[model samples]
Each structure stands twice: as C-alpha cells, then as structure tokens.
Target: MITLDLTLPDTRYPIHIGHGLLDQVELILPHLRIPQVAIITNDVVAPLYLQRLTQQLEKHGVRTIPVVLPDGEEHKNWQTLNLIFDALLAANAERKTTLIALGGGVIGDMTGFAAACYQRGAPFIQIPTTLLAQVDSSVGGKTAINHPLGKNMIGAFYQPQLVVADMDLLATLPERELSAGIAEIIKYGLLGDIDFLGWLEANMDKLRARDPVALQYAVRRSCEMKAEIVGQDEKEQGVRALLNLGHTFGHAIEAGLGYGKWLHGEAVGAGMVLAAAASQAMGWLTADDVARVQALIAAAGLPIRSPDFGAAEWLRHMGHDKKVESGVIRFVLLQQLGQAVIQPGLPATLLESLFHSPHIDPALARQ
Candidate 1:
C-alpha cells in the first residue's frame, strides 16, 4: 500500500492507494467519527462494489446506510443532493455519522458537498472507484454540483477524513471513463511538471492498456502534486489557481454541451488543447508545444477539438465561469509547457477568433 498525506492549514488526510484496499477494514475504521456509516453511491456503482464495502464495514460492527442515486452527471444537482439529505434525515443520522463517497466524480462531489452541509458539516471518507475520481476529484476537497449556468458553481472546500483509492476498482471502468481520467492526470503534467509530461508521453500506450504500475504511479503522482498545491494554498487564494489550468475552458464546454453529453474529462482534454492554442496565440507557447499537447490528448483517445459553439455562445457560457473577477473572465494560460498563469481580461479579438476558428468541428458550428 502507498499512502500520501494531504496537509492543509485547517485539516489533513491520508490518501491510501493499493489493490484490494477496500476490503481492508482497519485502514478505514480509524477515520470514522461515529458508528453509523452512510455510503453514497450511484446505480452504476452500487452493484459493482457497494456490497463488498458494506460487508467490510459490517465486519467492524458498523451500521451501514446505503443511498444510491441515479448514475450520470445529469443527476448531479440540487435535486440529487436533496436525496442524500433526505436519506440522512430518514436514517436519523447525526453529525457524527460518517458519509462515504463510493463512486466516481459525481458521487464524490455530491457526497462531499452533502457532508459539508449536513448538520453544519459531517466528516466523510472517499473511496473513489473510477480512475477520474481516484486521481483528481476525490483528493481535493473541492466539492460541488452543476448549476444550470456553469459546472461546479455550487460547492464548498470540505476535506475528507481519508481517501481510499483501490487500484483494483479501476479494472471495472469503461474505456471512455478511463480516458477521461487521463485528462486530469495530464493536467498535472501540463500545469507544472515537464518531466511528468515527458513520462506521460513515453507511457501513454501503457496507460491505455491499463498497465498496473502505470496506473498506480499516475494516481500517486497526481495526488502528490495536489497535496503539495493544496497545502500551499488551501482555498485557491493564490497558486492553487494554477491547478485549474484547463478547467475554465473545460467547464464552459460542459455547460455549453449541457452537462452529461460530453464527459468532464473529454471536455477537459479539448479545453486543454484550446488553452494551449490560446497560449500560442499569446506568444507564450510555440506551434511545436501546442502540437505536443494536442498529440498527447489525442493519443489518450480523448477529444482535442471542441464542438463549434459560436463566439457569442462561447462568450455566454464562459461568462458564468467561477474565475470571472469584477466582470472579467480569468483564464489559466500556459507560460510554457509545464507552467501556467492566470490571464484575466484576455483580448476580445483573440477570444472571438478562437471561438470561430476552424479548429472546431464544422458540423457543431452555430447556424
């Protein structure tokens, strides 16, 4: 088992990564604040791994309440969030009751948000099943649901008690979902680690083939990078914004496509390409660097080009982005490969040209 600690100013938690770690009760029991444990999952995930997790918790004499919601990003909203609250209320769960997020990014985000708001905050554990959740969403305490206007527009910075990432769970992931996870993994490399980017380039094939060692290292390195960044700036007051390298454009794509149509990771992959293109336009990145970024994303079987949403539509969706400050949208732009910076009030001409560019698929272009 490999363990990495995420130490923040107000809290700290350990992320445990290994095969079959879910069945190891001792690793989880220590983090429970109470005897009642609530497992929040989705329909897709409950049948796959929930029973085993419940059985493991039961072995430790803990009561389990399983709350399974519909599986999909479409359901990640206030309505679904209310289901968790309703379940907790019906179970007579107290603030001491520990909530366990037992699925992918949607489950982890909603469950963490539920924990944050339930009884003014209850502690929760993350048992991220999907590769996307295990490497990215599950580690950082940034929890939220999609607002009609934008993605993750509603949420909080609530930390988990512990993060249990069992690499074995990834074996069940759909091919598209696995590729989506690679998008976030690539974000870490793009944002600040050139060496890691090179490594990803060298091992892209192994990752796609589901090589065990590659999977473990990707998760570990992503977690380590997040831990270090979160420790430095817990609330995104500063350097943490760098972690959102492709997210602003990515979120816009999600909101534009109407959440669930394009998976978060797919949108991110394309968004990173867009961001790289934007960086090249601003003279920070060369054509070769942009090509490298696009090549890596495409090699991972992820989309590198966005749907052709018109400049007006793109502007409208981006207007709702969380990074907007004083009515100006702030973009995370590449200073170069492996380094990023926040660029606010990006020139309108550049933005419009990017939105109307031929890089976008013509079929998706506005009428």
Candidate 2:
C-alpha cells in the first residue's frame, strides 16, 4: 500500500492506495481511535462487499452497524441522510463512533455529512469505490448532498479521519463509471500538472484496461495533488476553488438535467470544454489551448460538447449554483494547460451565447 499524509490546518489524515487495502480494514480502522463503527453503504455496494466488511469489523472487536442506502445521485438527499442519523441514533452511536463511508462520492458525501451532524460531529473514513470519488471527492473533506435548487448546495466541509482507496474495487466498476473517473484524473493533469497530463495522454489505454501500476500512479498522483491543494486551503476560502475548474457549469448541468442524468465527471468533462471555449472566446486563451484541452477530455471517453439545455434554463441554473455571489457567477477558465484563472462578474447572457455559439458543433450536443 502507498500511504500519503494529508495535513490540513487542524486535521491530519492518510490516503491509502493499493490493491486489496479493504482486506486490511481492521488495521486501518484502529488508527482513527474509535470504539464503535457505523458503515454507510448502498444497496448496490452492500450486497457485494458488505458481508466481508462487516466480518472484518467484527474481527477487529468493533461493534458494527450498517445503514444501507439506495444508490444514485438522486437518492443523495435529506431523506436518505435522515435515515443514516436515525440508524445511528437507534444504535446509540456516540460522539466518537466512527462512520465508514463504503461507496462512491454520493455515499461518501452523505456519510461524511451524517458523521458531521451526528452528535455535532464524529470521525469518518472514506472508502471510495469509484474513480471520481477516489481521485476527487473522497480526499478533500467536501461533504454534501444535492439541494432541490442546486447540486451540492446543502453540505459541509467535513474532513475524513482516513481515506482508503482500494483499486481492486474499481475492477467491478461498469465501463461508463470507469470513464467518468478518468475525467477527474484528466482534470488533475489539466488544472495543475502538465507532466501528469502528458503521462495520462500516453498511457490512457493502460488506465482504461485497469493495469495496476498505471491505476496506482494515476490514483496516487491525483490524491496527492488534491491533498496538497486542500492542505493549503482547508476550508476552501481561496485557492481551493481551483478544484472547481469545471464544476460551475457541471453543477448547472446536474441541476438542469436532474442529478445522475449525467455522471458528475461526465458533466464536468463537458463543462471543461465550455470553460475552455469560453476562455478562448474571451481572448484570454488561444484557440490552440482550447483544442489541446478539448482533445485531452475527448480522449478520456467523456463528451466534450455541451448538452442541449435551453439557454434560458441554463442561465437560471447557474444562478442557483453555490459559487454565485452577489448575483454574479464566477468561472474557472484556462489561461493555459496546467494553468487556470477564476473569472468573475460574468453576465449569464455572455455565458449563454458562448455555449450557443456557432463555432461549437451543436450536432454534438445531447438532445
């Protein structure tokens, strides 16, 4: 196992990346200094891996309580989160009882939120099953559930006690889901590391095939980059927003289509294309820059064109995004590869025209 330490202001945690790390769950949990455990998983994940995880906890002499939620972004809401709290309460789970998030981003975020709110707060470990979760969501302590008005509008900045990413679990991921994770990995390269992006472009096929070394490098590098960013801005006051490069438009897509219509990474992939294109149109980025980014995102098996949301609705959705402040929407646009700048005070109409522009082939847009 490769372990990296993440040093946030008031908290320190380790990110473990390896094959079969889940088998070492017992050794992993004790470090969190907890006496009891509550695992929040989903029906999809629990049926396949729950028995082994439950047994492992039992072996460690930790009393285990499981709350299995229905899996999907749509199910990431107060109702499901309430059930987790109710279950923990029924189990008499205490302030110090640790919560193990045993699924992807949705499960991790909801579990983290539950731990944050349960008895004011409790420690939690992230066991991210999907690529998006492992590389992006799980490591950063950004826990959230979807709001009726916006994606990730209701959430907390609650860090995990530990983050264990078992690459073996990704073997069972569906092809589409695997592709979605690749989008975030590509983001790590595009937003900060040109060398990593070059490496990804060269070895993407191996990553798609799930070769262990390639997966490890990608997973480890992505996690370390995020850890470094989070360490610098533990509460996302500034600098951390760099991580939201594609998220503004992505969140709008999620809200417009309804969450889960497009996987978060998928939307982010497309959103990156628009942000890049917008950067070009604004004359801040060259055409070659936009093309390079578009090519990389397309190579990752993610859609590179904006979906066919009406211009009016898209404007309205962006208005509801949490990043909007004082009625102005801010966007992270590319100044160049491995470079980004946050552009603020953009009129929604300017963005709408950019997405609707003729330079982009509307033929590629999703109906």
Candidate 3:
C-alpha cells in the first residue's frame, strides 16, 4: 500500500492508494470522531461495495447508516442532496457523525457537502470507488452538485478527514467509466507533469489493459501532482485554478448537453482538445501539439470532438462557469503541454472564430 499526505495549511490528511484497503478497518477507525458513520452511495455502487464496507466497519463495533441515492449527474441537485439530510436527521446524526462517501464523485461531493452543512459541520471520509474520483475529485476537497446554470457552481472547498482509494474497487468499473477516469489522470500530466505525460503516452496500452502496476503508478503520480497544487492554493486563489485545465469548456458541455448526457471525463477529453487548439491559435502551441492532444484523448477511448452547441449557446452555458470573474470567463489554457495558464478577457472575435474552429466543430474534426 502506498500512502500520500495532503498537507494543507490548516490540516493534513492521508490518501491511501492500494489493493484491499476496504478490508483495513484500522485505517478508517482513527479518522472517525465517533463510532458511527453514514455511508453515502448510489444504487449502482451500493450493491457492489456498500455491504462489504458496512460489514467491515460493523465488525469493529461501529454503527453504520447506509444512505443510498439515485445515480447519475442529472440527480446531483437539491432533491438528491436532501436525501442525505433526511437520513442523517432521522438517524439522529450529529456533528461528530462522520459521513463516509463509498461511491464515486457524485456520492463523495454530496456527502462532503452534507457533512459541511450538517450541524454547521461534521467530519467526513472519502472512499472513492471510481478512477476519476480517486485520482482527482477524492483528493482535492472541492465538493459540489451540478447546477442547471453550470456544473459545480454550487459547492464548497470542504476537505475530508481521510481518503481511501482502493484499487481493488476499480475492477468492477465499466470500460466507459474507466476511460473517464483516465481523462483526469491525463489532465494531471498535461497541466504540470511532462514526464508523467510521456509515461502515459508510452503506457497507454498497458493502462487500457488495467495492468495493476501501471494503475498504481498512474494513481499515485496523479494524486501527488494534485496534492502539491492543492496544498499551494486550496481555495484556487492562483495556481490551483490551473487544475481546471479543460473544466471551463468541459462544464459548458455538461450543462449544454443537459447533464449526464456525456460523462464528465468524456466532456473533459474533448474540452482539452479544444483548449489545445485554442493554444495553437494563440501561438502557444503548434498544429502538431493540438493533434497530439487529440490523439492521446482518442487513445483513452474518449471523444476528441465536442457536440456542436453553436457560438451563442456555447457562450451562454459557459457564462455560468465558476471561473468567471467580473463577467469575464477565465480559461485554463495551456502555454505548452505540461504548463497551464489562467487567462481572461479573450477577444470576442477570437471566441467567435474558435466556435467555427475545426477543433470545436465535431463534423470538421472528423474530416
């Protein structure tokens, strides 16, 4: 088992990445303020992991409350979030009651938000079951539910007590979901780690084949990069925003497609491609660089082309992005592969031209 520490200015927590972590109750025992926990998951993940986790905790004499929510990005809203509150209130959960997120990003976000809001604040733990969650969402402490206006517009920077990223859990992850997770891993490489990026390029096939060694290295490296950035700027005051590499455009795609239509990672895949193309247009990257970005995304089994939302509609959806400041949308663009920059006040004509740019146009990209 490999452990990485996220040492923030205020607090520090351990992110445990390895096989069979769920079976290790001692790891979770130390983090719980009380002997009680509320395991928040979804219908899909519950059948697979909820019972096993519950059994492991219960054997240690910890009281466990299972709160199963509906799965999907579309359900990440007020109504769904309220379900957690209902379970907590009914169970007489208190500030000491640790909320354990046992599913993927959705479950983790909602549970963390619940813990933050419950009795003003409560401790929480993240046992992220998906690749995307383990490598990115589970480590960062950025918790949110999707708003119709924009993805993750309503959320908080609430950190967890501990994060358990059990590689064994990923064995059941669907191929599409696995590919989605790789998108974020690729993001870490693209944003700051050129060596890791090259490694991914060489080992893409091994990663796709789910080689245990490759998976562990990818997860560890991705977590290390995120932990470093997040430690420096926990609230996204500066460098942390670079982590959003493709998120501004990706969030627009999620909102434009009405949520859940395209998996977050898939949207990010195409979004990164668009960002790369934009960089080329700005003279930061060459045409070959953009092609390389697109090729990597395609190799990951993600979409390289975005759905055509038209210029006006695209702008409308992106206008609500959390990165927008003073009505100017800040973009996390690349100055070069492995170096990201946050820039605002892009020219209206430049955006108009990008809308018609081959990278943004699905039909044109295919041709």
**Candidate 2 residue pairs in clash (backbone atoms < 3 Å):** none
The alpha-carbon RMSD values of the candidates against the true structure, listed in the order shown, are 1.2, 1.8, 1.9
Candidate 1 runs further than 4 Å off = 365-367
User: What does candidate 1's lDDT look like per residue over 1-367, in tens digits?
Assistant: 9999999878888999999898998998988888789999999999999899899889789999999999999899999999999999999999999999999999999999999999999999999999889989998799999999889989999999999999999998999999999999999999989999999999999999999999999999999999999889888988888888878888888888888888899989999999999999999999999999999999999998888878888888889987788999989999999999999878999988887665577664332
Q: Which ten residues in a row have the lowest lDDT in candidate 1?
A: 358-367
Q: What C-alpha lDDT values do all the predictions have?
A: 0.92, 0.85, 0.90
Candidate 3, which ten residues in sequence have the lowest lDDT sum?
Answer: 358-367
lDDT of 2 at 226: 95
Which runs in model 2 stand beyond 4 Å of their true positions?
347-349, 358-367
The TM-score of candidate 1 is 0.98
Best by TM-score: 1
Per-residue alpha-carbon lDDT of candidate 3 for residues 87-154, written as tens digits (9 for 90 to 100): 99999988899999998888888888888889988999999999999999989789888888889888
Best by lDDT: 1
Q: Residue 356 deviation, candidate 1, in Å?
A: 2.3
Q: Can you write out model 2's per-residue Cα lDDT over 306-366, one digit (the tens) per residue?
A: 7666677777888887668798777887777887788885666667688676534455345
